[model samples]
Target: MKTQIRLLLLSLTTSVFFITTSCRTELNEEIGAPQEQTLTANSKIADLILKTAMNDGSGDNILDGSSCFDISLPVTVVVNGTELTLNTEDDFEEIEAIFDQSSDDMDTLEFIFPITLIASDFSETIVENQDQLDALIEACEEDQEEDDDDIECIDFQYPLSVSVFNENSEVLETITFTNDEELHDFIKDLDEDDIVNISFPITVILSDNTEITINNLDELEEAIEEAIDDCDENDLGEERFIDVITSELLEVQKYKDNQSNETNNYRDYIFDFSEDGTVLVTLEDNDGDDTNNVTTEGTWSVRTRVDGGLNTTLDFGTEAPLNKLNNSWNVKKIQEKRIMLDEREGEGISKDELFFQQI
Candidate 1:
């Protein structure tokens, strides 16, 4: 019930492929990346120059002189006194190239006098006739600013805060962001292996003070349903459900297939879940040869829903129970002695189902 980092039905994996294309394409032009960088007026120009070009590179955060890492073709940058049609890394090298270098060494270039940069998508940034590139580099040492702690200080873009909560409806932590630079620091400090999966209703307080709340599991499912309803289902449909649940196996307690004339074949089934994400189903062979009973195995997992509920699933190369438990189910009670899974009105496996009890 409290704020937690839970599922938002956002494509966690597919988003990885298109995140730069989707999010970074329209970064605020007024600010530099890594906003906590200390810079003189000269280095500010350089950083903005590199940041804008790297953005144009589209997914390469740093310039490495490769085509993928190269700033796109036919752009213009007025460095020193020359406006060059900068297409490739070689074109950039015309300004300055080091041959006495280590292969791993990052290639470097300093802006010239009366510097100006023109990106493919952004307007021009100009610094007119200040000093030569070498003179500006010399001034960086003289102009570096210091903090109260005597460390070099980089200007930040202000601060924000986000709240985190847990499954028991308890406050876990409230994270504060001092600035855009601090945001990078916070991400860099996180241990991916140590990240905990909490129940949802996670709230983000942006710098401009707006709120986005993915309240519950049903809401996410509704979002997917609505998204499909708004467009053709053939287009990126699985991307819609990818974040909700990643293929969990549900135990077949009592399956009553309405289309089949089957009744007594559903008893004496037990489920075993292995650490390697394998689900094994052992059931009594009422209809088949008793001495040759087989074990059906697949994959399984339970994830926290947006509403603080849990989804339990089962799959063995089919969609009987997986399709059923894919929807949100409330937790009536859970303890060492017993567990209760409450199913709501939706696409369910059974018709006369009351509740699930495991003791």
Candidate 2:
């Protein structure tokens, strides 16, 4: 009997200890601290994210709220006083997956204590057009969620201003970004021509609203060249030919046609847009019965307006699988070997969006 009682007591004690431990873990966030980019308009840019920018599971303490970071530093940014570093692209991606779902305001980056980090906030800043610039500015002006201890920190320190140029290489306007109200004002005054992807030496805006004044002349010049293309084309802009569109290595990429905001990523179909405006759609696992892995052919072209916001139009010839892509959609944006196209609200496209990347 004594031995049995002892055993029972030991088991109970162990159970109690475990329960207490679990409770502590559940409450750890309250006891401890928390931690937490951007466009290519919000989630597309992968390299710009840093591991240090993640939110502290609590969602209330998103450190890299502005998606701004200085990669040159070992520790990119601090969140709730914790130091973090990005070892790989995955580190940044993890943060992107978490905080992006948040509609709440984010916490300003906070250092552990007395630690100094000197680095250029963002390594590369590409303002593709006026819409992108507006998106970047709006992202920065977003208010940090309402809280008892939330800091009223905007993305930048303040007195932020940037120059806008026309396609003719003329200065259009130099607007100063101060608060969300000012951002709205800037947007109101924005013209389609002011939204050029043409010239470079552009001031890249950081997720934190911080600005890096023309990192180099190359990016600036590239942007200007793109602008010249548009200006030279009489504002209708030249076509993004099939060759240039599909020239991103090996000539193929997988695309997910997300309709009604739903993505069929698992479909994983390869879209091969050839130089002759022909599109070859292919998928694996041919059964020769019911659903053959047949290559579907289609035509493609870049339109100036009907596609709305200057993008490409695809005609899959009303075929079984190709009919889904028979709409004119704007180029959502392109990064390296990837191309994303989506339908604008006022545009004549009925589908949602298509995301393509070299698989």
Candidate 3:
């Protein structure tokens, strides 16, 4: 009986040790093994953010910018056994958190719905990051320059021009001159439709090549219209007129001819006045296929009546021309005419100015 009791006790002790050891082994495995995470296909949230970054004024290449995000921590984006890093620029960490919470269980291969970018938390964070982003852009840019190829040059397709005239085709005012450096300085001081009065003497040539010097505004306007009406009417629609009158103006019409294979072409805008001072402007490309028929309806006014028309601030009304051009920028020089401004990581604006003489 004593031998049996001792054997029984030993057996009990051994069983308990085995059970504890087994429990510990399981616990260790759980602690050591990586959690099975369901990796979805590349997220559209990623794509949209990347698209915005591409146009973002930071000038960083979009692909390079995307690659810069290193997501090696609390946020993990896994694809086909490969893990990519997510850069923290633009407050992507917030996006990562949102993506984490929204992802459903499928710890390995999973087709998940896209992450939302419009959530209040995400939106606020994105906006804040965008505001502070300029501070961090310099460092990001340096990193990009080191890691990627230079960005391709963005070229403007058309040379632009703006000329003012009276009923007799008189050139009242013109801003289509070259001399980029000086023009840039000139435009910096003037607001839109704010008639920038200038008394510079300009030399004009008649259809007979008879050059006449005019110092007064009245004389200049008269001479300009006569030259335009009298210049070879056949060559009027062509770029030669622009080139002869306004030096350095690109022959966009001709240049576009070389790109005739393209479905979309530049739209021509001709702002002219009738005898009764009615502005009749047509916006259409004279050349190209039917696909090129894109036009926008817009209003026009002489600079004098722009921005409340020379009245004091008290008389200001929203209907004034200055109001239309309130926040708009103008170009005084051809070289400085093309401008590309990025407002945030994903939003950008580009503008190119062309100038032409009324003559």
Which candidate gets the maximum TM-score versus the true structure?
2
For residues 1-359, write the lDDT of model 3, one tens digit per residue. Answer: 99999999999999999998997566434332332211112332222212211211221112112212221222233432335344434433333344335333222211121211121011211213332333333444345435432111111111212232222332245555443223323333333333233323545444455667655445544554444435212211111221232332222221111223221222254333222213333345567565675433333211111111111011112543212222222212112112111111222222322232231
User: Model 1, residue 196: what's the lDDT?
Assistant: 24
- Residue 181 lDDT (model 1): 41
What is the C-alpha lDDT profile of model 2 across 1-359, one tens digit per residue? 99999999999999999998887565443222221100111211111121111211111112222222222222354533434564543454434344334424342333333222211221235343435533543343232111112112212223545545443444445566544335334443445444212122335443334555543334433333333223111111222333336765222233345444334532545667776667777665545453666666777765323112245668767655557667776665544455667765663443466766665
**Per-candidate total of colliding backbone pairs:** 12, 16, 24
TM of each candidate vs. truth:
0.23, 0.30, 0.16
The candidates, ranked best first by lDDT, are: 2, 1, 3
| C-alpha positional error of residue 99 in candidate 2 after TM-score superposition, expressed in Å | 43
| Off by more than 4 A, model 2 | 1-244, 248-268, 286-292, 306-308, 347-351
lDDT of 3: 0.30
How high is the lDDT of residue 142 in model 3?
43
lDDT score, residue 348, model 1? 32
State which candidate, 1 or 3, has the greater TM-score: 1
Clashes of 2: 16
Candidate 2 overall Cα lDDT vs. reference? 0.41
Ranking by TM-score: 2, 1, 3
Give per-residue lDDT, candidate 1, residue 168: 42
Angstrom error at residue 24, model 1 = 72
